[model samples]
Target: MALDPTDVGKIAELARLEISEPELTSYVHSLTQILDLVGQMNAVDTAGISPMAHPSDSPLRLRQDIVTEQDRRQSFQEIAPATESGLYLVPKVIE
Candidate 1:
């Protein structure tokens, strides 16, 4: 899949991009190389390969889930303008 200037121009137009003439040539070369790499990769056989969640097989280490901070909800609510049932009240702006 080789990308020419015409194809690059159409791609740029479809993407709403304003590419200059010199930039269009550069894009054509770069995009053509990328497509060629993809074509090469697609030519390989991977029939027996299974999908993996990760590249490595090691299990991830996790930290213990516990409370590390003291409760300050009551102190914060005392300083607020309005709070009811442990919730801060705000003025309604929409009908």
Candidate 2:
């Protein structure tokens, strides 16, 4: 699970990042430790344990869904710079 300079360079290139030689050394060490920790975690035996969505067993409480506010679209649209058919318009950004 050790990461070398070449592995760090490839990761930096793929992520569009610029890493100095000093920073690259630090990154390599940190990444290697993280990978080693993950490797250790993966080596643990969990054959009898079932997968869970949450760590706790508490039930979640949900509120009733209902409209609690009045629509003010016309008032807001009247103050907008551009509006057409109750929809706001903006300048085209892409060709």
Candidate 3:
């Protein structure tokens, strides 16, 4: 399941990445190792095994959502460089 250098070169070209010879060699080696490990999994014979989300059977606990704060809009707007009609102002970009 090793990736071809030609495929790598094409992928680099499509991604606009500048791959040097050393980088290409390093990436190829790393990618080859990953492919070999994945290939090893195909050797396993899991004929009828159920997939699991977690190793344990316990459900995860979650926190209750609560509103705990309020914004001081007038106090915040007082620090703005520009504001009008209860809103911060910015330079108009289009007519």
State each model's C-alpha RMSD to the native. 10.4, 7.0, 8.3
Q: How many collisions per candidate?
A: 0, 0, 0
> Candidate 1: minimum summed lDDT over ten consecutive residues — where?
42-51
Q: Can you tell me which runs of candidate 3 are displaced by over 4 Å?
A: 6-21, 67-95
- Sort order, lDDT high to low: 2, 1, 3
Error of 2 at 48 (Å): 12
Model 3, 1-95: lDDT tens per residue?
A: 78877777887899999898888988887888888988888878988987788999689987779866697889999999999999889899789
On TM-score, the candidate that comes out on top is 2
Candidate 3, residue 73: CA error in Å?
A: 16
Candidate 1, clashing residue pairs? none
lDDT of each: 0.90, 0.93, 0.85
List ranges where model 2 is wrong by over 4 Å: 45-95
Best by lDDT: 2
Runs of candidate 1 exceeding 4 Å displacement: 45-95
**What local lDDT does model 1 show for residue 65?**
100
